[model samples]
Target: MGKAQKNKTVGRAEMSGVERLGLRVSAMINSPRAQDRCAALIHRMEADQDADWEEVMSRIAETDGVSMVFQDDGGVLLEWEAPTDEDRVLELGEVEALEVEEAPF
Candidate 1:
């Protein structure tokens, strides 16, 4: 019984970062240039490379505290503990609603 209890906790399913991201991340990422300038620069640098996982991590390490980590399944994660004024979320970013066109008379 003790082993079964322990196993249950250890084997619990977890939500990967991508799964957690889902639809919410779309707005946050495209929040009208709300991304931190430095972070954006880092993102561009990574995008320009053909580097592998280790290389990406190494390049990201050059930045102060920002990091881009990819999950085994290629889910990306960007993390930075430091929050400067520019990084502040002034408001919840919004996604535009779909528009429907009326038939012409």
Candidate 2:
């Protein structure tokens, strides 16, 4: 018999300003409402153009399902509910496509 596994109920992460910006961009690109706006911003950011970080952070914080807090040291604390078992299963399937390519065939 296998031991029971404990479920994680919440998740937390601390990120630097740049990392938080990337996370916000990822979330926006996945959102139906924000996708169109974020696509242009992504291109500008990637091209080292004038994409303001503060403005980006403010916009993302206003989006639905996003909760953002800025730290005094300019870092970010992100918190969210842990994925349920059903969500975990779907994510695991996606992870299978992300296998590392370091091994020589």
Candidate 3:
């Protein structure tokens, strides 16, 4: 049988407005499939203090594997599929060291 997939959600309850926006923007910028226009918009957002936040959010909503829902409190809820055990990378550096006894000379 196939395993059930888990989803993760981030929102106003967990972070401030600026933090949430930063997370969303970072996700969009890191997406490999992001379009040139989106890149331009992101650059503009960085350069312009008065950039249109709604436009940035609308673009975020269009990202693959991501969804944004507007809340009644004027906040957004971001949801995406959580990584599974198969998605996790094993790091050799994180392995515990083995203790060895010194050989008699």
Candidate 4:
């Protein structure tokens, strides 16, 4: 289970029109058969409706290990990962939401 933190700057009551974001991630290793084990995390942020997943992913990918952030609403933001240095704090410092490429699955 993951712990939820409150952002005093963005009061809970103020989270009215903000849209939720979903983040997907996969580790990249310098190796042969470098298969990226992709996974995703979801965050509910009262952000501008115009914010797109690609834009959010590009912003978050600036850091190491930051995979991606997608918009998952209506409880689609399930599944959480163990906390790490990046996730230690409430805010998703660099990465926020899930990033996944369109592959023929």
Residue-level lDDT of model 2, residues 12-99, one tens digit each, is 4556656666775677556665443323223324432234576666666776654565666555444334445765555676788866
Question: Which digits, one per residue and each the tens of the lDDT, describe model 1 over residues 1-105?
Answer: 699899998998996543333323444444545455422212322333344434544554686776766656545566656476776556434324435579898
Worst 10 residues of 4 by lDDT: 23-32
Model 1 TM-score, 2 decimals: 0.27
Choose the strongest candidate by TM-score: 3
Full-model lDDT, candidate 2: 0.53
Top model number, lDDT: 3
Question: In terms of TM-score, which candidate is stronger, 2 or 3?
Answer: 3
Ranked candidates (TM-score, high to low): 3, 2, 1, 4
Between candidates 1 and 3, name the one with more favorable TM-score: 3
Give the total clashing residue pairs for model 2. Answer: 0
Candidate 3 has its poorest 10 consecutive residues by lDDT at 3-12
Tell me each candidate's TM-score: 0.27, 0.31, 0.35, 0.23
TM-score of 3: 0.35
Q: After superposition, how far is residue 54 of candidate 4 from its true place, in Å?
A: 4.4
Q: Report residue 99 deviation for candidate 1 (angstroms).
A: 49
Off by over 4 Å in 2: 1-51, 86-105
